[model samples]
Target: MVNSLSKRCISLLPIYKKVPWKSIVLHPIIHPRFKFTCWLAAWQRLATADRLLKIGVQVPLECSFCNNAMETVEHLFFDCSISKAIW
Candidate 1:
């Protein structure tokens, strides 16, 4: 009965696709903090200004480092000039 209940519970849970970056982001050798950060970024769940604004928090939309565009996971990691320089 327990086994059947567990299977039913699991079946009720949401399904997600296999993310391509999971292996790289969750490598055993990676630091836990960095791994969590990468996980949030990979899911586009990082609390960037744009995301904060969506939840009604008042914050400037500009990128803090480059001020060229809205702060977002993509801009912070790739599109921002300052981040590109640092990387």
Candidate 2:
């Protein structure tokens, strides 16, 4: 006799939940925005004492979408024309 699909899935539940976070950290193609946001966050974090002091780098920075005006994290993620279409 064959087991139901739900039974098979349930059998793997414990193993699935036990998987470590490190197992997937290096896997590519997980999520495009996840990688991009991580890179952007790292860049912002590592900017510098001088760059942070600059008006442009501090806040209201140029939009990554158009590269023609000021950018905010919101604009980069959703408000910009190019990114809004993507979302």
- What Cα-based lDDT does every candidate model obtain? 0.93, 0.56
lDDT of 2 at 58: 55
Candidate 2 TM-score to native = 0.33
The lowest-lDDT stretch of 10 consecutive residues in candidate 2 is 42-51
What's model 1's overall lDDT?
0.93
lDDT of 1 at 19: 85
Mark the regions of model 1 whose C-alpha exceeds 4 Å error after superposition: 1-16
Error of model 2, residue 34, in angstroms: 2.8
Deviating ranges (above 4 Å) for candidate 2:
1-60, 67-69
lDDT of 2 at 15: 58
Give the per-residue lDDT of model 1 (tens digit) for 1-87. Answer: 999999999999999988899898979999999999998998889999999999999999999998889999989998999989998
Candidate 1 lDDT trough over 10 residues, lowest sum: 17-26
Candidate 2 C-alpha lDDT tens digits along 1-87: 257877888887775444344335446866867655555544554333334546455543566457755564545555678877887
Every model's TM-score: 0.78, 0.33
Error at 22, model 2, angstroms: 15
